[model samples]
Each structure stands twice: as structure tokens, then as C-alpha cells.
Target: MRKVNEENERIKRRYLKYLKAAKRKDPSTVQKAADGILKFETSTNYASFKKFHIEQVIKFRDRLNEEISKTTGKPLSKSTIATILAANKGFIFWLADQAGYKQRVRHTDADYFNMDAKGQRVASAVRESPYPSLEMARHAFNYMPEVSEIDQRNKALFAFFMLTGARDGAVASLRLKHINLIDGCVYQDAREVKTKNSKTITTFFLPVDDEYLTCFIEWVTNLRTEKLFGPDDPLFPPAEINVIDGAFKVVGLKREIYKNANAIRQAIKEAFTRADLPAFTPHAFRKTLVKWADTHYPTRQAFKAFSQNIGHSSVITSVSAYCPISIEEQGELIKKKKKRNEDD
Candidate 1:
């Protein structure tokens, strides 16, 4: 069987470039769009984009419906299906406008790639995701052992996350200079840190338990005084591994930054597991912080500041995306409002 069509590959490259340069999509989003197009090409046996048809879309949808997820070993989810279809649909629509393919592909035929109304609803449903509460986060931080350098670093990392709801990518790339201990703020300079959308963010240390701030301060002091680390040194450096007893083992801290957030995530997972709590991703901390903000900063100006602290441009983005009220909490709020109305 033919592995790939040269014409299709050329068109795909152009489409990906358009997504990045014109649509201003991030790398991950562009990669997803690339994957979606690849999957559609595979389904069509590497057919050229000019050969795109409504029947081909219908057949591809059927194939995706019967496909299984490699990670979960289950059937493909409706959301996953919808995402893949949407990518292909967008590509087909664009192809219809292109010079060479304009006569071959119909603009309206791209609409056939869409899932039914019921399927769309299922794909777009807002389901609650599990995140550690503030208490649970504090418990996890307190439980993290600080016996060794690695242990101390891990504990500090957790405390830092609690103190400022910065994303994992930003945390992984932070330098000592970026954090102002006196000001109690983290300057996520996009030029130096791997921030989301390359956005520069100034995050003030959130009002949380004092213990978390104390832990982080001590860790930074140790790095500066004991380890002789400079301002440019990583806030949380990677572990130095050496062969011990004919086996590779982590011995001490390395004076280098992490290549990515994978190590940071593992450390967080281990810490939570050690604390007998569910391992939550660093992003979950944002949700916890947003929820905390909702209760403490009820006023619009205060809430907006809190949102901006977490790198959100708008308060609505923070509330709609992160601080979803639980069903139980929603009911209690409504009941409280009813009592207030009756009193008035």
C-alpha cells in the first residue's frame, strides 16, 4: 500500500503553516491539527486533497467511531472524534478556496465533516475535573519529606505552586532572579520562562497558609547561601544523577534547569502520593487558587486582579474556565439567596 501522497504532504505543510502564522495557533494546537489531517489522509489511503468528498468524510467518521484509543484501550471518545473531524473540515474548507483545488473541492462539502447535533452536545459537555482543595494541597506540602536535597527541592516546588498559581512550564524555567522574595511576587518573564502563549506575567504570592511561604523562602536561602547559586540559577534545579553501587541514582542537585516540565510533574505526583492524596497536575492548582479567589475576592476589582495574577486577561476566563461551582455549592448558594430575599 502507498504510505503517503506527495501532493497531500505538500498541501498539509502549507495548511500547518497557515494555522501557525495566520491563525496564530500555538505549537501544540498546530500539532493536533496536523495529526487530524494525517488521520484523515490515512483513512482515505493517502488520497490528494483535491479528491476530498462528502462520502469520504462519512466513511472517515464511521471508521473513527469504531476506532479504539491507544492510551485508554477503549473506543474513541465523542470529543476526540469531533476534534479530528473539525480539523479535517477546516482543512477541506481552506482547500476549497485554494487555486488548484478550488474547482475540485466544494466549500459546502466541508460541512459534512461535522458530527450530528446530539454528538456535538456530548462532545462539548462541561464535566468537572478533580483538583486538590486548598487544605488538601497544604496537607500534601506538609507531608513532603525534606530529609535530602531532592526532598527539600520537591517540598519547595509544591509550596511555590501553592503560593503562586503559575503554570508548570513557567515553574520549570524560572530563575532565582525571577522571584522577588522581598516583594513576594514571581515575575514570569516570557523571554526567559516557558510561559503559556509566551505571555509575561507578574504573579503576587497568593494569601495562603504562612507555612508554604516560609518553606519556599528557606529553600531559596539554602540555594543562595549553602549551594552558592547565583541569580541566574534555576529556582528548582534538576537532580544530579551518578552511578552508585553499580546503579544510576540521584545524588544531589544539578546547577542546570529542566529541559521540560516532565520532572516537575513527576515530583508533584510523588509528593501527592506520599501524602496519601490523589496525584493532581500542576494546572489543577490554578483551579484551587481561582476557587479561593472567588470566595475571598467577591468584589469585581479584586477578582479581576486575582485573575490577572494567574495570567488570565479577563475575570470571565478565570471563572468560566477554572472556578466552576460544584452542583452542591450551587444549590446551597441558591437556597441562601432565597433566604436573603425572604428576609428583605
Candidate 2:
């Protein structure tokens, strides 16, 4: 019947602080660890961590496996389960080394939280995710209507993603000063823009269709001259909603930045829907750029430059994370190599 434990709460607070301060984990990552600990606590009915047992872990694993996701209305996925277990395992292992509870909890007890080999493999398996090709993106962009200001902004937003391969968060927080239209690059100043890991990235426009660059140029030009927006104003302003005929409608730009990337994502979805294409997330454009770079920039130096432009510190991270080879492409590459061998 107990809902909370004071002892557990004190320990959890210290643990979360350690994760943030010592481990240098981000706020979201720390929150996940907290959620994992809470799950274990709930399974044990708010029992003290000092009374931790391997049986508790077993029961928690079983419960998680049988758990259904409220959002998906389906059983929890292997990856999700694994992630939860890993978080708990990490916390328990750290707890074993902490003062006062060192005698009660053993480091080996944490091993019980791990999934079996097969489960781990299934959870970690790499699969190809959907992203638009350069040609497909161009086709979609061409179909985007540019009659109204909202339509123009939406169209330009899609093109901006393709042209710069900047992340949605950075795009949402960008100001007019961040973009260099003359140099065909975006200066993602972490102080102003919400860049990932607060990295200050300078991304040059990729050499795609001229239409993408042209569209973005017109939008920025209009923002500066026609709208009379200053450098401090939002590059892609949030929609200004007004009541017309007792109905709320997006009347025009608000001249303010989006608090998050949600609005940017909606704009992207609308653009793709209008173009009769799959509504890909703004991040998908990074994968598209990586895929294009794999074929276009064959040399190591050229590829490294391309990777750096997209905010990756190393080429390996860019290739391994984004540039997944399809089965069809893999087979064709092998066959081509065999043909070259035979010719020799």
C-alpha cells in the first residue's frame, strides 16, 4: 500500500545528480535512468533499495516483457525493454559501490538485469530507415505551392533541410543572422541555435538541385526586405494565429522562433503531404545527404569535409550511423567487383 519511500527518494536524488555531474549525462538521459529506477521501485511496491534481490529483477523483467505501451497499444518492444533493463542494471551496479549499501547489494546482482544474448541481439539489430532520395525530394519540392506567405515558408523550410542538412532543433532556433545566403552556408551558433550537444556547426549547402538553393534565397530575401525582419528575428517564424469568422486560422508569421522542432516537423509533414510523398522527419534529410555523399564524394578528404559540414566530428560516425547499404546495392557492388576480377 506504500506509494513512496523517503530513503529511496534521497538515494535516487544523489544518483541522478551523480549521473548528471560525474557521468556528464544530459537531462533526458538522467530522466531515463530515473524512470528505470521508478519502474523497479513500482515492481517491488516501493521497497527500500537496501532490500534489493535478484528475484526483484526477474519479476521486473517479466513484468516489462508483458507490459503494453499505452501509445502503441502493443506489447513493449525488445529494444524498449532492453533499454529499461540497462538503465536499472547501471544504477544497481553503481549502487553496489556506494556507501552504506555495499554489504546489502552485490555488483554481480546487477548482471541479473541484463537480457539474454538473443534478446540483446534482437534489440541492437540495425535496420534501414526511410529517407527521401535527392530526386524524390526535388519532385516533392516542385509540387509545393508558394502562393501565400505560409505556403512560401513551408516550401522554403523543406528546401532548407535538403540544402543545409541541418537538424530540426537547430533550424527551429535559427535567427536571420545564422544564415549566410551569400556564402551558401548556415552558422549554427550554439549560443543562439539549439544545436545537438550544443555544438557550433557551420554547414555549407550541399550540391543538390539549384531549385533548393533558389527557394531558400527568395525566402530569406523576403524576410529581410519585404517583412522588414531584423537579424535577431526568427529565420522561420512561428505562425500567427487569428480568429476569422469565429474560427482560429494561421493568419501570418509571428516573427518569433519555435520553442521546439514540433512546428518545423508539422510544416515538413504538410509539404510532403501536398507533394504526395511520405511525410519524412526533418532529420531524414541528414541521412539523404550522407547517402548522396557516399556516392558523390568518394575520396577520404572530400567525404570527411562533407561529414564535418553536417556536424559530425568524424567520418566514421556519419557513415556508420546514416549511410546504410541496401541489400540490392550490396549485391550489385559485389557483382561489379567480380566482373572487374574476371576482366583482369
> Using lDDT as the measure, which candidate wins?
1
- Tens digits of per-residue lDDT for model 2, 120-181: 99999988999998887888888888888988998999989988899898899999999898
- Best by TM-score, which number? 1
Q: Candidate 2: where is the Cα deviation over 4 Å? A: 1-3, 97-100, 342-344
- Candidate 2, which ten residues in sequence have the lowest lDDT sum? 267-276
lDDT for each of the candidates?
0.91, 0.90
Kindly provide the TM-score of model 2 when superposed on the true structure, using C-alpha atoms. Answer: 0.91
126-161: candidate 1 lDDT, tens digit per residue? 889999998899888878888889999989999999
Give the runs in model 1 whose Cα sits over 4 Å from its true position. Answer: 337-344
lDDT of candidate 1 at residue 190, scale 0 to 100:
88
